[model samples]
Target: MQKLTIQWQRLLNDKNQTCPRCSETGETVNTGVLKLKNALAELGIEVELIQKAIDFSVFENNPLQSNSILINGKLLEDWIGGETGKSKCCDVCGDSECRTISFGENTFESIPENLIIKAGLLAAAELIEN
Candidate 1:
């Protein structure tokens, strides 16, 4: 069977809590991954999700890196032809701005599951083509 991997990274505070945006995105990602697994199973494509926690030191340097999603090693935005932006995040993220995704007129601080599913389908298409 072929494989498609979805990776998500988010900043975690000392208390191991992520910002509200990241927390919500994580839930969306989980749902997206499950949906992809079921949708792609018949196509012989296996969906895998890898969630990573970024250390405070790392997030401090590049907060934009937090709450990032990658599908099959490519940025989720890249796959969906979206843009990456940053906005002020909550207390768990300190003063650093967190990652956001812009899809045309819509800008999301917490990524929507539809976007994830769309990206996963695109990735799955590429996997089949290759």
Candidate 2:
């Protein structure tokens, strides 16, 4: 059986609250990915979405992308980024020299459901992209 993989590495920025943009993006990805999972199950295709909100410091040594969506271990920019792609200030990780993780691809706040759905379909592995 073949399994599709969807990974969203949300790098935490501020201590008080997760970045609004990232928060929304994460929620969209989670919900969309879950739906994709159930849909693919009928085809006997497994889906794995790594649900971990990692810190910026970890991204420094992260094998995968920090603020990006990866499908089947491939870094493909199909989802949304933060307001600014630059690192933001964080009091909690101040001494740690860690800042908010940004990808700089979006000027908006939310990741569209359609985008994640597209990503999910692409991650199916068996889908033929023409």
Candidate 3:
């Protein structure tokens, strides 16, 4: 299969999509493609799969709602703080887990994509058939 490269901006413009985390946007960065790509590439599966598989949620304006990535209808939690686990605080409480000796190290957070891979294929296949 040809590698799929989805420009972040282009994909986020789709009217049918919404950011599951913050609900403000469903942009590409929400999928953690850039960060997860390195880890995923090790598995031999194209990072494009992240774009292919996205899951959307209802649009609601709530401050409590996280604007992070969603994986399989779940918020992509981060143990490490910041973008891609660099200088990140605790995913929980957003605390400085790194600096405080009492606080443990940060961990990996998993965010959900706007579309799930299976759902993406279904949508793609439907488009093709039509």
Candidate 4:
């Protein structure tokens, strides 16, 4: 079976806690992965999810890197024709602005599961085409 990889990264404080946005996105990602697995199984495609944690030091320099998702090695926003932006996050982020995704008129701090599933489906389509 072929494989589709979805990678999500977020900032982790010393206590291994992340901002609310990242935490919610993590839950969405997990749900998305499960959905994708079921949806793609018949197509001989395997769904793989990789969760990465960015240290506080790294987040201090580039907070925007946190709460990022990549499908098939490409940004989720790229796959979905969304725009990437940033906004001030919660205390776990410590005054840093975290990543946001903009689609049309709406902008989301915590990425929604629909977007994740959409990206995963698009990626799975590409995998099959190739």
Q: lDDT of each structure?
A: 0.92, 0.58, 0.31, 0.93
TM-score of 4: 0.97
Clash totals, every prediction: 0, 0, 25, 0
What lDDT tens digits, residue by residue, belong to model 2 across residues 35-54?
98888889778888786677
lDDT of 2: 0.58
The candidate with the higher lDDT, 1 or 2, is: 1
Flag clash pairs in model 4: none
List, residue by residue over 1-130, the lDDT tens digit for candidate 1. 8889899999887888888899899999999999999999999999989999999999999998899999989999999999999988788877888899999899999999999999999999988889
Query: In candidate 3, residue 72 scores what lDDT?
Result: 33
Over all chains combined, what TM-score does candidate 1 have? Answer: 0.98
- The numbered model that scores best in lDDT is 4
RMSD of 3: 12.9
lDDT of 4 by residue, 1-130 (tens): 9999999999888897988999999999999999999999999999999999999999999887899999989999999999999998788888888899999899999999999999999999999999
For candidate 4, the 10 contiguous residues with the lowest summed lDDT are 88-97
The estimated TM-scores of all candidates read: 0.98, 0.62, 0.26, 0.97
Q: What lDDT does candidate 2 reach at residue 83?
A: 29
> Which stretches of candidate 2 lie above 4 Å from their native place?
13-16, 58-66, 78-109, 125-130
Better of 2 and 3 by TM-score: 2
Candidate 3: tens digits of C-alpha lDDT, residues 57-130: 21122112333333333323322222333223333223321111111343323223433232333333333354
